[model samples]
Target: MPKWISLDFGAKYKLSRLKLWFRGDLEYKDGNYPTDWDVYGSNDPNPDGSWDSWTFLHHFDEPYKPSGLPHKQYTQEDIDYARSGIDYEFIAIPEAYRFYRIKFNETTGNGAFIIITEMTYWGKLEE
Candidate 1:
């Protein structure tokens, strides 16, 4: 089983950097990955009707070997760590009118699994 992480955006400021790490062994067959995850933000806690569309940030495999990484950039098991490891990062935090939120959707198999590990909010407090 693999692990995932997320961060929350609020009604104070937009995010600039996001760092994430995946723990545990990951296995992929035929080189197919699920498309999930979204960035959201709003003032209300519920944040209903106030969410951005789902987007693709990054994709990795158990071995981290790209079917054809240009220039042979990434190597197999590039992010594989038996004891400790780090996985992904995002530099551009969407220009949220107010805040930012992260939604993870892992809809791939008959069994649906989506988990949130971390959620941090970065911004100025409202007066």
Candidate 2:
């Protein structure tokens, strides 16, 4: 099964970028990070709204392989890099949104889960 996470920004904002950090723990190495995912944004708060109400922001289909090492055994630098987070700039998206969603389609390991340690969104509040 696929996994997803949603964030409510409370109000509409001109989203500029997003930062995502995956779990850096040494024990949970297999399939800990997302390999394929899609990002969506929505301003409609109605629960009955359809999926079409959300706008597609981006789709990442590449594997999340920060460390080139085999067996997914990462070095200290890799761990630090993961902890620092990966940035996704939304330069093409000019619209404002009140909510953001991340849908995970695949993971690095055989597991069916995606482990994200942190998520940060940068944007300017709509006036």
Each candidate's lDDT (Cα)? 0.37, 0.71
lDDT of 1 by residue, 1-127 (tens): 1323333433445444443433233322111222345554454444343234434333422223334443223445442431133234444544443434444444223134532233333334442
Candidate 2 per-residue C-alpha lDDT over 51-118 given as tens digits, one digit per residue, 9 for 90 to 100: 76778888875433466665556677667776667777765676878888778887768577767777
Instruction: Name the best candidate (by TM-score).
Output: 2
Q: Which sections of candidate 2 miss by over 4 Å?
A: 45-50, 63-76
Kindly state the number of residue pairs that clash in model 2: 1
Q: Report clash pairs, candidate 2.
A: 31-109
lDDT of 1: 0.37
